[model samples]
Target chain A: MRATVIHAPFDVRLEELPDPRIEGPGDAVVKVVASCICGSDLWPYRGDPPVKQPRPIGHEFVGIVQEVGFDVRTVKPGDFVVAPFVVSDGTCPHCLAGYQTACQNLVGYGQGKADGGQGEYVKLPYADGTLVATPEVPDDALVPSLLTLSDVMGTGWHAARSARVKAGDTVVVVGDGAVGLCGVLAASRMGAERVVALSRHEPRQKLAKEFGATDIISERGDAAKDAVLELTKGVGADAVLECVGTAQSMTTAFDVARPGATVGFVGVPHGVEVPISTMFRNNIGLAGGAAPCRAYLPALMADVLSGAIDPGKVFDSELPLADVAEGYAAMHERRAIKVLLRP
Target chain B: MRATVIHAPFDVRLEELPDPRIEGPGDAVVKVVASCICGSDLWPYRGDPPVKQPRPIGHEFVGIVQEVGFDVRTVKPGDFVVAPFVVSDGTCPHCLAGYQTACQNLVGYGQGKADGGQGEYVKLPYADGTLVATPEVPDDALVPSLLTLSDVMGTGWHAARSARVKAGDTVVVVGDGAVGLCGVLAASRMGAERVVALSRHEPRQKLAKEFGATDIISERGDAAKDAVLELTKGVGADAVLECVGTAQSMTTAFDVARPGATVGFVGVPHGVEVPISTMFRNNIGLAGGAAPCRAYLPALMADVLSGAIDPGKVFDSELPLADVAEGYAAMHERRAIKVLLRP
Candidate 1:
């Protein structure tokens, strides 16, 4: 079996590795069908977060169950399933509260012994609680869309929920990546009357419009805020989804939100100072974090299966698993909305 | 008429000022029976905030309406009333939504007006919306407690409401000033099972206990969080009311709150940095701001009138109007819980 590893800054290698097997009572071994790159993965790849070891790279995957442990009841051999990037025991208080990402037994797939979908075979614990069985083995034509539900699509959905984007809400989604593009779709699905996507890429903006972005602002700082104010009659957006985790993007989200609105930040923040004085006086709510992807995969998968939403449109390029390094470079250079790797 | 003027940092003087008259169709003139110094007044007094001119200092007051404008229909001359520190028109969209502090027609008494309660008389704008009339003049003993319904007591109640303290919640209040003590009373009134007061002062802690604080944490930082977590079976407090707006207090509030709980902050935040990263991941909802004093005064007045709560005990000192300077210094040095200055 071959797996991608980030050995150092800007370095990715396709290394051969041994296959996995069912290791625990609640565990199941699955053969990866498809996997993809993520923005979060870039943190380590760019050396912003130092790599402690040659780390197994990919998290998102849709696969077929190869084997199951004695206690695995819901999924079995040959079943096509969407395995969440992070495995969680679904019975904890936080999990019951629908915050599975914060579950006590949470394990990030492919980060450690949790070897991820970048490999041909991976062991998933708490299979009954972590993996969702599809109606059938989805055809190759639908693989890209189904694979996105593993992380990005559901993450975007989580961002929309955090901001409380309801019907008739004027929404502003900040970021042009796959997650941000998917957020536009999620906001539209949740009935936002208008969605303004802030993106500089024409290709990404085109997809954003298709996902229900009513407007676009390529400007930064004051210009972007002025444009939003003009569109909202000086009231600003009812909800702002901050999909890019940077000091500037967070500030833009708050500046473009109306007093008493919410800024849902799904981006992993780095070098950011959250201005409390502004948040307090403005009376806005801040909500969002690492998404509980497992919690949302069910409903999102249903939408994909029913042909109501095509979140897979975010994957603009696809490559064979053997050339995963090219996929990483393309994404790092901002050449792809998302890069899909067929395992 | 004479009013107290903040001439400079640490300088206050009683100077002759012209008597105020009704200036608008929705205004009235009131003969101030009582006016008190507030913690917020110190911001301009100490010059932390800009004080361009000698400004009138008091905002909290109870008085008798001496004159009414043509459109002032809620109360007439000779009516005993509690004047909300914030004068709201009660007819704007925000006012209708119960956020009268953000009213389109808002006027901050004393702070914004040339004539204020520090003088013998003050002009009240949006009088019908800002003044809550009593059926009759109460005994002199109830004056202090009733006056509090105009701001401090009502503001603390606003904090408790924003935190959503329920019947069975274990609430932690940060701050030991009049507002924090009043929050203990408000939390009890809202049916919280347990209330913890974070204070080191013996007198304020005693008052907090009287106001239904089941526990007191004299310690701060990690020790305080440990105490709260131990009390809550290592889960932290169900709700936290942040009545002190410093960065340390906000950090403490977030540290001591249970997952998915809310923190209501009523104190004017000063140099506060909210770690929104922690807040988002923990599912902590931060809600609060300038208390819509007009919105909560009615309920607090009813509670006071019915003997359901007594907020007057928070006043540890009282002084004649001429001695307000000393009262302000005492509160600034933490030597007094709150002071009532009688004019």
Candidate 2:
């Protein structure tokens, strides 16, 4: 089997790996049909938090179940399934409470407990809990959108949900990445009257507009905040989605939120400092993190299949599994918003 | 007239000051009927952030409106009123949005814009916005509870509201101060199935029990977190109230919160660092800040007026207005949970 591995910074490679087999009673072997590079993957790749050792990488994918252990009841061999970025035991307290990302018995793809999603096949535990099957395998054209249900789309939806976006709200999205673009779509679909996207990139801005961003601001930092405040006539945004996890992004997210509004943050924080005084003084709240994608997969998958949304447009570049390194490079170089890989 | 002023650490004195009179169209003069020492007052008294100069200090008081300017419409002379900790123009977007603390024209008591609450009289602007007048002046026994509405009781209610305390929740309160004790009351009123108070002090624990605490854990730090988890059979509390502004208190607040729970914090953060990674991993949320006390005043005042809640029990000591110095000392020395001063 061929899989992706990162030996060091700037060195992701497709390497031959032994075939994965179901090792637990609740495990299933999945033959990945599609996978992709993520902005978070760039963190380790760029040495922000450098890789310590060579390891399997990639956590988002859609696949066909090739084999299933006896205990697997929700999914079966030959079922088309979408796997959330993390696996969880279905009946754990947190999972039962709809926060599978914090499940007591949680497993991450690419870690030793589960095969990397960027491989030909993945053997994973908790099949009933982790995988969601489409009603039927749809046309090949729907693969990209369904594959997104594995992480980004659900994550974007989580940001909107966490921010408590509602009808007639003015929402601000503070990043232009695929997830941020999807957040614009989520807020708009949630009935927000105005969706504001902060983006400097022309391509990403175009996608943002298509994703239902009623306004776009090509500014950064304080200027971006000023633009948002100006757009809303100094009232600020009713809900803010902090999609980029940086100190500056987080600051702007808080700065542009109206009094009593919440900043729903889904980005993995990197050198971020929450402005406690600002949040306190303005009565603004901060919520959301490491979105529970599994909890959102069912409804989001339905949205994708029904053509209510087309988040697959976030994939501006595509590559074969063998060219995964180029896909990583293109994304890192900012040449692609997101890159989808076919196995 | 006499006013309380803080010249330095451990030095609070009631000294002669000019009598206050309305100077703005929206202004009103409030004759101090009752004022109280707050935990926040001890901040400048002990001088964590050292007081720069001698300044008037108190912000919580119940009073009778002495006079009102021509523009004052909601309150008038001879009316018994409860003044919120801060003065805000009621017509601002934030104020209209039910977040008076973040009102565009916000004025803090003792900040020169308004006379210190611990004074013979307070001349403040935005009378219609900041002062809530009762239908009629009630008996002296109701004075203490009504005074609490100016700050602590409303702050506690804000914490519960920010945490989104719903029916059937298991709530945890992280501080044993007046605000936290009031939070127990707030959570109970909101229909939490269980209200847990982390208090080691016997007096506070007793008050907590009276205020609707179903469980009391006199543990600190990790032990406290462990105790809460054990109480919930390892599931953690559904909502947590962080009423101590220290780093340790904030940490424990997050530690005891179950995944998907919100930690509603109302203490003024002094040296707090948010646990972003922990919040991200568990999907825990942090909300609430310098509570919009004015917004909550009307409802909480009704609760107090009806004798449904007696938050005034938190005041363990009382002093004449001239002995305001002793009130500060008693509160600072931990000899008094809270001290009420009669002017």
Candidate 3:
């Protein structure tokens, strides 16, 4: 088997490794059919938080169950399944409450116990709790969309849900990454009358529009806030989805929210300082965090299969698993919105 | 007219002032029947944010409408009304959305346009928007409860509402002041099965228990968090009301919130730094701010009038209007939970 490993900054390689095998009663081996590079992977790749040692690296993927332990009842070999970024016991109090990301017995993909997702095969625990199977393996064309349920699509949906986006809301989506684009789609699908996307790049803006962004602001910082306020006729957005976790993006998200509106942020924060005074004075709320993707997989998977949404468009570049390094490079350089890899 | 004025820290005086009169089409002059010294008033009294000059203070009061501009419709002369801490037009988008605190034409009491509430008479704009009148004058005993509706009760209700307290939830309140005590009542009224109060003061603990705190944890800081976690079987409280705005209180509020739980904070934040990373990793959400008390006035008012709640017990000390300085001193020295004043 071969897996993606990060040796140091800007150094991701597909290296040969021993094949994975189910090691626990709740474990299963998945033959990776599809995976992709994520923006977070860039955090270490760019040395923002430099890698300390060589380790397996991906956490999103969809594949066929190649083998399953005796205790795995929900899925079996030959079943197509989507694995959320993290594995949970599903029976823990948090998981039972629909927050699998905070599961008491949680396991992260590529973190020793579970094989890295961007690999030929992944042996992971808590199979029954983490993997969601499609009703039936559908046409190959639906793979990309289903693949997204592993993280980005569900994460985007979580942002919209967290912001409490409702049918007549004017929603502002900050960030034009794959997740933000999906957020635009999620808000629109949730019946938001107006979905605003803030993006400076032409390609991302076009994609954002395609994802149902009713308006696009190419400005950054205060100017972007002004544009959103202008678009909403000085009322600001009813709900704001902050998909990029940076100080600037968070600030913009809070600034453009209307009084009493909530900013649902999903981006992993880095140097982000929440404006407590501003939020209090404006009666604004901040919600959303690491999305519980597993909790959303079933419904989102149904939406993908039913063609109610087509989030696969977020992947503008595709590569063979062997060209994984190029995929990482393309994403790091902003040459690709998201790169899909075929195993 | 005589009003409470702050000349400097530890220097509150009751000085003779000119009688107030309706100054705008929407203005109303109310003859205050009862007013209270708030926790926030102590902010300036203690010089955390030093008083710059002699200025009328106090923003919580219930009064009889003495005079109204021709355009004032909802309230008229002789009508008993409860005034929210701030004045709003009640017609702006934010106001119409039920966030009167953020009204486009918001006017705070003691700020030029609206006369300070502790004064014998208050001339305020946007009468219809800021005043909620009772059906008719009732027994004087109801005066205390009704007066609380002006701020603390409504603000406490806002915290529970903001925290999204639901039936059967285990709610934790982090402050034991008037507002936090009210929060205990609010959560219990909302059907929270377990209402926990983190209080060390014996007087407040008794008041809190009377207000429906099912459990009392007198520990502070880390011990408090451990107590709450232990009580919830390490799952944390389903909802947390952050009634005190200090950094330590805010930190504790986040620490004891269960995954997927919301921390509804209403205390005016002071030097509070939000733990964004912890929130993101645990899926704990931070919501609620200054609290749009006006929006909640109607329902809570109805509850008070019906004897469904008794928040006025929070006023542990009473003083005549002429003793305003002593009232401020008592509150500043923590000799009073809240001080009620009679004109």
The DockQ of each candidate is 0.45, 0.84, 0.91
Chain A TM-score relative to the true structure, per candidate? 0.98, 0.99, 0.99
RMSD of 2: 1.4
At residue A228, candidate 2 shows an lDDT of: 92
For every model in order, the fraction of real contacts preserved is 0.36, 0.80, 0.91
Candidate 2 is graded, for docking, as: high
- Please, what are the lDDT tens digits per residue for candidate 3 over residues A13-109? 9999899987889999999899998888889889878788999999999999999999999999999999999999999999999999999999987
Clash numbers, per candidate: 3, 0, 0
Model 3 off-target regions past 4 Å? none
lDDT of 1: 0.85
Report the CAPRI category for model 3.
Answer: high
Residue pairs that clash (backbone atoms under 3 angstroms), model 2 = none
**Residue-level error in angstroms, candidate 2, position A124:** 0.9
- For each candidate in turn, the TM-score is 0.91, 0.98, 0.99
Which residue runs does candidate 2 get wrong by more than 4 Å?
Answer: none
Interface RMSD of each: 2.1, 0.6, 0.7
lDDT by residue for model 1 (B110-201), tens: 66542566667888778887899888887778888898987889889978987879998899999998899989999989999999999998
Q: What lDDT score belongs to each candidate, Candidate 1 first?
A: 0.85, 0.93, 0.93
Task: In angstroms, give how far residue A237 of model 3 lies from its true place.
Answer: 0.7
